[model samples]
Target: MTLYNNVFETVRMIEKEKLDIRTITMGISLMDCIDSSGDKSRQRIYDKITGYAQNLVKVGDQIEMEYGIPIINKRIAVTPISLIASASGEDNYLEFAKTLDKAAKEVGVNFIGGFSALVQKGFANGDRILIDSIPQALSETERVCSSVNIASTKAGINMDAVKLMGKIVKDTAYLTRDRDSLGCAKLVIFANAVDDNPFMAGAFHGVGEPEVVVNVGVSGPGVVKCAMEKVKGEPLHVVAENIKKTAFKITRAGQLIGNEVSNRLGVPFGILDLSLAPTPEIGDSVARILEEMGLEACGTHGTTAALAMLNDAVKKGGIMASSSVGGLSGAFIPVSEDEGMISAVQNGALTFDKLEAMTSVCSVGLDMIAVPGDTKESTISAIIADEAAIGVINNKTTAVRIIPVHGKDVGDTAEFGGLLGYMPIMALNKFSSEAFINRGGRIPAPIHSFKN
Candidate 1:
């Protein structure tokens, strides 16, 4: 009887509250595809991805139809190209990115991640090549996404990589300026980036993951907000409890779908990422969820505390529903992706500094934010450094995915359409961090990271 009731409740959530699985990401390891010859390596990479993910879209659609649930995206994350391209002694890794894009298009997936380099401590040969190639690689490819990790709790922050990534990001913006610099939208800079994340543009198969696996990212900001509406004027504890209960139901649905997909595909189930990923659609906003918790608007004085509670309750609920809960399992506060966030920024209620504070507790950091076209590269590096410092000190994952839309400024809108959404250019500090960023050295690991 309880199971039946739960099913009915889930159906209601889907029907009226916009609950759905955000992504069904297949993580395919490409370690064995490495070859000294770049052409051979890229060919093998393309073959493996296309072969493994050929039926990904069809299977996702089938599952959606059978269960009467919506799967918003079918995507793929491969082992970071830096590792594979290094074996080929490739100076330019654009061919590898093209291969990933080709494989994704062949399989009909929306995006393919892991054109990445891990340089949290220092740059290796492959890391340098991949990092240098990111602007061209991303500019030339449609479905390929790229990331570079410049900081981690264990190894500390690599200032050199941070500085370089700033220039890379600016260059990418210029390369794709014709398209509102959409290429920067597909790039992420991370501190302690996870391997099994199903969300892009940060998803990548970790070095320790299985050869092939299925990971799912479930989202329900609308559901949570609707649940909160039912308990209006309730005590804060009661509100927290309601959010937890709603999260449990959302996560259970994700686990069910993940298990079925993994079984059908004959691949191991990786993890259920219960992130409250929002969209531009009405009612599907993380900012609205916080507003339901009593904020006049997101980025107000109480926003950070409210987000902290919301994030904690979500993790608590999701963990109980799935033992395999991993990746970024909390609320996401992407500025452009959430309608409420976009509104808040436009209304002058949300500022860049406030968003930074909110990210200290949210799942990801400084996501999908847009700045003026002429924003200095050093300033961008400073932003990455600040976000990275937070992640390293707290031992949590944090990232920066800001876009400097070329030829756009404050009060102007940068439109990308679809799930990429649109954003009103926000103001920046307008200060120079060139001296600090130019001091290229590693920041030592925090004392708390010596837990071993």
Candidate 2:
């Protein structure tokens, strides 16, 4: 591997820009694991996951150690259980989720996504069942994640599913209210969501992939932020170039590990998602990168412009680095996960409205944010609607993982602990969207929707 004298500088950049491989997710398809009998199908599901992924975490650790690059998470995303709809009865969805959770825990994986249903156009019986069961399933499981695809560039947003999800989010929060509504933390509603995203709670093995493949997600928001600090209010062009250069180094680190892991595991190497995935850690923050880029605070008036530039530059560098780069390849603005961002929100420097604006350029949507527990379900849906609209219109992927902490209101803090971090619930606009949102059938695809 080529080496450089800028190693320490690179690490400093990584620390500030939240630049690290967010996740190295192994996608394992289990379509062939279905059987006519329920018991046999259950066993097939477990065995298939275990047999395919027993070595995932172990191998990932080895790769991380050898490459000297941190792999923040090693996980597995499977074909959505809804695909094998006939294997289990509608009422039996929980068991399937249990089986998945079991296999994930046995493999030493933190989260296993793909307990999903694709309803961009419409829903199936199985999809409906899984959707309905999400609150219970998530409340009961330790590591299972659920996502619903309600919109896409071609199909537009699904208001029906979005409404259902709002209720589900509320219910999940209620069920886990004592635990900070963590069950809701495992859920996301997406528009144009990627099938091969290595990040959760939205990641799921795309149906088009091989039986087993490894995709890596690398982040370096800190790296970029550090670079921006060095430039210190240089012209916008220079700032963008600095971001690109920092991204290049981070992508190189991801490439080094991704290739080595794929080779060791004898699986096809997949995409390198060069997203700026922040954590609660002091230095790892996408928001901090923006702050370093001259924003007084991340949720301020200038934040969106800063984030948009940062997002575009990272993509430029990552695209140049690898042919397989994919997923939500932009700065992720998860409030709770970034100590700086959470503080910004708590201090009234960041607001939910500004957060929505930022998602237009960010990788994920409204992630790890906290709101009033009693906030209307329709308001939650409105938040989802806003994000889906941006994604659909721009033909890009966007998603929401908002957590309405039960019994908590604006300015009150809610702690999720660990990497999820503690969040201060930001105040919501008291205005109602009921009149506008209630009339929804579909937000028609954007004017740029023309493919021909």
Which parts of model 2 have CA positions greater than 4 angstroms off?
1-19, 435-440
After superposition, the stretches of candidate 1 with alpha carbons farther than 4 Å from their true spots are 1-7
Q: TM-score of the candidate numbered 2?
A: 0.95
CA lDDT of each candidate? 0.95, 0.84
Q: Write the per-residue lDDT of candidate 1 for residues 337-382, one digit (tens) a residue.
A: 9999999998899999999999998888999999998999999999
Each prediction's RMSD over C-alphas, in Å, is 1.0, 2.0
Q: What's the C-alpha lDDT at position 17 in model 1?
A: 95
Pairs of residues clashing in candidate 1: none
Q: How far out, in Å, is residue 270 in model 1?
A: 0.5
Q: Model 1 reaches what TM-score against the true structure? A: 0.99
Q: Which is the leading candidate under lDDT?
A: 1
